[model samples]
Target chain A: MNTVIDTILAHRSVRNFEDRALTREQIETIVRSAQAASTSSFVQAYSIIGVTDQKKKEQLAEVAFNQDYVVNNGHLFVFCADLYRHEIIGEMESVDVLPSIESTEKFMVATIDAALAAQNASIAAESMGLGICYIGGIRNDLTKVSEILGTPNRVIPLFGLVVGYPAKINDKKPRIPLEHIYHENEYNSEHESNVQELQSYNEVVQKYYLERTNGKRSDTWTSQIAKMLEKQSRMYMKGFVEEKGMNKR
Target chain B: MNTVIDTILAHRSVRNFEDRALTREQIETIVRSAQAASTSSFVQAYSIIGVTDQKKKEQLAEVAFNQDYVVNNGHLFVFCADLYRHEIIGEMESVDVLPSIESTEKFMVATIDAALAAQNASIAAESMGLGICYIGGIRNDLTKVSEILGTPNRVIPLFGLVVGYPAKINDKKPRIPLEHIYHENEYNSEHESNVQELQSYNEVVQKYYLERTNGKRSDTWTSQIAKMLEKQSRMYMKGFVEEKGMNKR
Candidate 1:
């Protein structure tokens, strides 16, 4: 197997980070790699805010549901889905091109575009021998996160990524078998038989959490999601995304 | 700067591909990298259909509006946003777990998860010195692409990626300035100034197309998007996604 593939397959989210600051050159390379990712129609509807200020990182940490890693990380980047670029073009050309909920196509494109760019940045960071973790809790309270990031309309903050040298490596989380997800020419229900495989993996996941959390609460993957869903932890995200002028009508 | 950074910074789409077959080991590495990307709650809500069969690739090309590159590429990967795995979990537990439009959170996570995985796969391919081009045309007619790929409900075909050794390296496309997209702490409205910078880069983009097409319809970046948006392309994707039992309801 290729070295990169080995690194990828052995991937783990690194929350603890060495107390070192990332060089500006490092940030530039990661951002450039992000910009290089495929964009939908080259709209490039994404921007990343590199937060280095300690005070700001603390604020961001608070907004990211108080994740300690956010504050202690070497670098914190918040990826935003932006449409203001097109709005500028529209204004210059005297057209009404700003995306709205009616323009669901554009909304989807921008969101996916932002995601692709963020993913590229993540991969690049990993290749650079840095540990990284994504902060999806940025959506836990979108309005507050947006306020903290100073995000504007048509520019919803999707997630934050914390990057640094590894203080430690977390074990790789187990995934449901491919047979459960990959289907042939059409989606065949027969592939559903792989759920038992998932159950087997659940023990692996339980062990992972137990080791990490010292068995305070033995959380299985299913229960984690079930609890998350039961409370609709990030439920405000839909209204929040719209309020940020993403799915406008 | 590292060679990987150089490669990523100079990234460009490669539409015209030469006849080449990707090694099996290459496919395994790339797919494994995709699997390594972060999954939402470790759900791994996605899958890739490696379309190596020429007959199937030809059919896919037809559905994607005859994008010849899809058929000619050494590899065609259909990256799917899958909820099928979760649905099976629901079935096994005798629970109703299909995500609805009201389940906007699920939709968002699944989409982001799948795109992140695809991006990892793309970077891994690039690291191995391969060319990649994403096929958004897969969404031109979601139903057709889904049927062609045998996609299941709650598993939407987000995009296709055509990868292989490049026939030749194309010049890197210039990006919109960081100012145009990146905001400080809040959203800024100085996008008008950014547009001026874009004009010069737009020329670069136009020149790129001209060089590639021998001056055939040298459309600038803005004009290309205008032309693309002129059609109702992907306008029905939202409804189609929902109709496929995705219940983006």
Candidate 2:
């Protein structure tokens, strides 16, 4: 209805970017907007790493399965769920806060904080006529990713946000209908009805793929998800998070 | 720099809201903006429960430690990390997907998806001259909250977002300095320098609190967080998430 909502609704991940670098002023504005997001309990348990070094970007691109945008974007921002600063606060205050810091609750807070901030940054960049893509592929190998970033304990790199001028913009993918995703008063647990809704949505998604790929592909959303989930990926995430001294409780 | 960035930077939680309900159009726009956020691998592993029933809102308020805003807002949206739909997809496709759904990586993806969507919703609400607050207090009693929302297995309620016209607007809280929260190329892990930066930030926060409370309170950010973390809260979150059939790996 308005420009802000328009900006939000127009969001599409841009994988290909123009050969242009973002000015420092743009980065500052984006990061400042990120900082303004509502943090859980005001903990602000997140940090952003601006990857400008080409060598470091190359390493991150490798970690992200060689997504060229990871290296070629106007900027690369690695959002980290960080409690290391909180740990430092505990030491300075002489508070035995390790138990709570190690709790899953804190972990959730940090993760949520990072996501909220990154989304804000994304919106801010988009509003400035930039395109952004969230690179979750970095999680393919968190250990190597962390080593590349030189992140400390209690700091987990969640994902990368690559922002730049878009070389191409794809059609927005259809989402599950609002009725299927939004419940009123209480959750609607009618499994049969939900399955029916998905069945219909599956057709819509299939049509989308068919058109997008010129009838070469027609996979339904359900089939895609089921195929993806048939085998476990990132099974070591639990151990890695624990090793980072988070979510240990 | 633009209106969108301006709207994002001006955000502050509004606890005391006008006693007015959101229009259907407003809620739709908000949720649509939410759905526009990036989802990991298009999993879209989240649901939003809109609690408009008075009795349910009252129970949620109780679960949120008697935070009346839970019931008094323009609307309440309980964001859930939902894998139930994916599980249903698996059943329909006759594909075993439980192993991946139960992984910690999937849990993180769901949680991050929910947070990203919620933040978008929050910003959309704010841009429309409304105010929003994220009620992590809902985590105070997850089982009870789930019971109230009638959430099924693999559908964990992460937090609540209350949006409404504001009755009061609090001053925007200061964030950690950009230098501290923003690193260049790699994570700046210089503990001593980081601690010094925080110490400087602590004074700013203390001054803010002192002014806001009319000299009645003057707690530093570090002291506040340290005190909160000194006593573990929501210690059951891990068990609760596990019981919900998530993060098992």
Candidate 3:
């Protein structure tokens, strides 16, 4: 496979990072790649904060459940699903452009625009031989993030991404089989034969955890998810989003 | 700049395509790249339906407001925000995983996941010197898409992407400057100077449209968006999402 395919197919989360800092040029390239992604109606309704401040990084690490890489990574990007930019544009043009909750479709388009742009940056970083990890924990303390970042109303932190040189290479985490996701023309969840095939996958995942952590927890995928969902982590995000002006339909 | 970075940085929409068929290996590699993206809780809540059949592609293009490139492209993919797979997994484990609008966070996560993954595929294809365009018009007729694709409950079509070799290279579209998007700590729309900056952009966009369409209509970015949002395009998406059983908090 070509280098592009290689970078993509061989993708993995890189939490540990080297001490080298990302140069301004590299950061510009990454964000430029992000901006190159298609936006709905050319309304690039998103903003990324390139956080390089040490104290701020430490605070973000705390917010992200003490993920050490947040403080150590060369570039910490907090990607926001921003309606504020467009809102400002509307204000300047003297137009009332706020689509209501009845406009669930517009909301989806804006959110998807932010997400697609973020992934473009991730892919570009990986292709440039940089390691990256997405910090969903940004949502864990959503209200704090908005306050810390001085994000105004109509823009919410969707997620954060930490990018840098890898301190160490890690083994790949196993994903649920391709069949579990890709459907023919319709969604076929009752694939009895695929369910039977998952037995081997359970074993595969069990071995992966054991080998990766050296038998630290020995948790299977099923148990991992069960444990995760059992307790509400960011259940407050609903109110947080509403407070941040992302009132859903 | 390297080829990959150039491919990414110089990215633009290619609304025309040759009739050459894409190889299966190309599609598989792109999908694999997509699958390798960071999914929320490893749920991998997305699916890509690769449309190679001519009749189906034509119908899909029609659904997307007669976007001729979609039907004529080598590949057209419907990217769905899939929750039914996880719901089935929930059932197999005898756990209730019925996602609701009340489960608003999950819905957003799934939608974001789908967008992120689809974007990786788009980037991968682009890096390999392919041209692609995203079709948000799929949301313009969600019920028809669901029916046509045989999508089940909790699976919504977020967007569609058309991929193939470019028939011609289009001029790069101008983006709003970084000063407009990059907020240091919080959103600051106080800089009224952006209006003047946007006037220059309006000129660039107008020239692009005039050159592309032989001056059929004089349009600016604001005019385009205003035209698009003037009608109720996705008027039924809220009720459609509710009908699909995603009644969350």
Candidate 4:
């Protein structure tokens, strides 16, 4: 209904971008908006790494499974769940904070903080007429990504936000029906109704894929999810996170 | 620079809300904007439970340690990291998907998805002249919160988003300096430089609190963070998440 709502609704991941880097002002504005997001208990437990070096971008692109867009975007921002600063605060104040920092609750706070900031950054960039895509592929090899970025312990790079001028805008993908995703007062656990709703949603997704690919690809949402989930990917994530000195509790 | 960015930059948690519930249209619009957020690999692994029942709100307020805003807001939305629907999809398609669904990777994906959507909802509500606050306090007792919400397995309530008209607007909390939070090309790991920046930031924060509380409170940011982190809170989150069939790999 308003400019902000319209901007949020029009969001779509842009993988193809025009060959132009963003201005310093644009990047600052976006990051500033990101900083304005709510932090849990005033604990701003996140950081952003702006990858501008061509060599570093190339390395990140490799870590992201050779996604050229990772390097070719106007700018790449690695959103990291960082508690290292809190560790520093602990040292400065002479407090033993490791017990709480290593707890899973803090990990959730940092992760959520990073995600909320990244979303604000995405919306800010989109408002400036830039297209953004979140590169979750960076997690495919967290160790390598962390090494390349020189991130210290307790700082896990969760994802990358690629912002650039879009070469082409794709049609919006349909989301789950509001009724299916939104529960009133309590969660709707009616199995039969849920299954029926999902079945109808499957048809809608199938049609979208068929139309998008000119009938070359038509798969139901359930089938796609099932197939993807059948293959266990990134099984080492738990160990990796723990090894990074987080979520050890 | 624009309306969207302006709305995001002006964000502040609104706890004192006007005693008026949101219209159905406002809730639908906000939820619609939330759904438009980017999901990883099209796996929409999250759900929103909007609590409207008075009794349910009171129970949630209790779970949130008697934060009356939990019950007094225009709307209370519990953003959940949900994978139960994916499990149901596996059952429908006769595929074993538990291995991947329980992986730390999927857990991160679901949690990020929920946070991104919640941020969008918050911005959308704010854009419409409403106030929003993220209720991380609901996380204090997640099991009881889940029971009250009637959530099934594989659905962990991450946090709540309270939206309403504001009865009072407090001064915005100052964030970390952009330089402190944003690193260039690589992580800025110089301990001395970081400590210096943080020391400077502590002054700004101390001044804000001092002014806001009429000199009654003047604590440095580092001291506040250190004090908060020194206390062990929510030690059962990891086990709770594992018991709920997530991040168990």
Q: Considering the two chains of model 1, state its CAPRI-style docking category.
A: acceptable
User: Which one wins by DockQ: 2 or 3?
Assistant: 2
The candidate that wins on DockQ is 2
Clashes per prediction?
Answer: 9, 0, 11, 0
Stretches > 4 Å off in candidate 4? none
Interface RMSD after interface superposition, model 4: 0.8
| Tens digits of lDDT, candidate 1, B1-249 | 555556557677888777998887787777777888897666677778888777878888887889999999768888887776676666555555653323656777778888898888887887787889999888777777777777767778888999988897776767766555555455565555567766876787888788888888587877766555545556676677666665243
Predictions in order: chain A TM-score: 0.89, 0.99, 0.92, 0.98
- Tens digit of per-residue lDDT, candidate 4, span A160-202: 9999999989889999999899999889877888899899999
DockQ of the candidate models in sequence: 0.47, 0.90, 0.50, 0.89
Question: Per-residue lDDT of B69-128 in model 4, one digit per residue for the tens?
Answer: 999999999999999999899999999999999998999999999999999999999999
Chain B superposition TM-score per model: 0.88, 0.98, 0.90, 0.98
Stretches off by above 4 angstroms in model 1 are A99-102, A203-220, B94-102, B203-218, B245-249
Local accuracy of candidate 3 as per-residue lDDT tens digits, B109-168: 888999989988887888777898999888878888887787877788888888999999
**Candidate 2 lDDT over residue span B145-248, tens digit each:** 99998999999999999999999999999999888899998888998899899999999999999999999998999999998899889999999999999988
* Evaluation by DockQ, superior candidate among 1 and 3: 3
Q: What's the lDDT for all of these models?
A: 0.74, 0.94, 0.75, 0.94
